[model samples]
Target: MKETYGFKTVPITLRESYSASKNGWSALLLDDKNCKEPYRSKKYDIEIVDRVGGGDSFASGLIYGLLEKQNTKDVLEFAVAASCLKHSIPGDFNLVSIDEVEKLVKSGGSGRVER
Candidate 1:
């Protein structure tokens, strides 16, 4: 798909809750460099205030990372972390800043965000 589509990287969501008891999500990044990086979000075990916009938040974070030209690892972590925090929010709109997401991504990042 990457070759045919000329995609530099392709991201696929991993909703662990669909298969397991844990309500968390992860992501898979298929890089054009023949690398498959799996990024699991931190901040799992959080009580979800709202279940809306998880995927959108994830995509936003990914976009932010890409726009900022961050590293792949950081990008994935940011995406998952952003989505994780978004779940704690009470609305479909995510209001978190770049700093907050970076903090979450930097500290104890890459695991799974529990809902």
Candidate 2:
């Protein structure tokens, strides 16, 4: 089907969660060799005034990474990083720049803290 559409196809897995105990949602980018983990996860952060559209933000970031032809690991990292940034902002748009996402990718989750 992908070849028919001329799209660089990727598989998407959706897990069903009926557990009210589940406090958050996440998405994982799957490829050969277990290349990445779930891209986003939130354990009920107290600061979030609005929970709507957060998943859309994650989807945006993942799609952005894929458009850049990022490797599975980088793609997952970018998505999660973007989602993290999304948490700090108040809007429908994630509003994170590609360079910022790249910085986080390069830092391997341990970037410097500049105040």
Please list the Cα RMSD from the true structure of every candidate, rounded to 1 decimal place.
Answer: 3.9, 6.4
Best candidate, lDDT = 1
Worst 10 residues of 2 by lDDT: 38-47
Please write out the lDDT profile of model 2 over residues 68-89, one tens digit for every residue: 7447766666765566556556
Residue 56 alpha-carbon offset, candidate 2, angstroms = 1.2
lDDT of 1 at 3: 66
TM-score of 2: 0.55
Report the number of clashing residue pairs per model. Answer: 3, 0
What lDDT score goes with residue 87 in model 1? 77
Measured by TM-score, the strongest candidate is 1
**Reference-based lDDT, each prediction:** 0.70, 0.52
Query: Where is the poorest 10-residue window by lDDT in model 1?
Result: 38-47
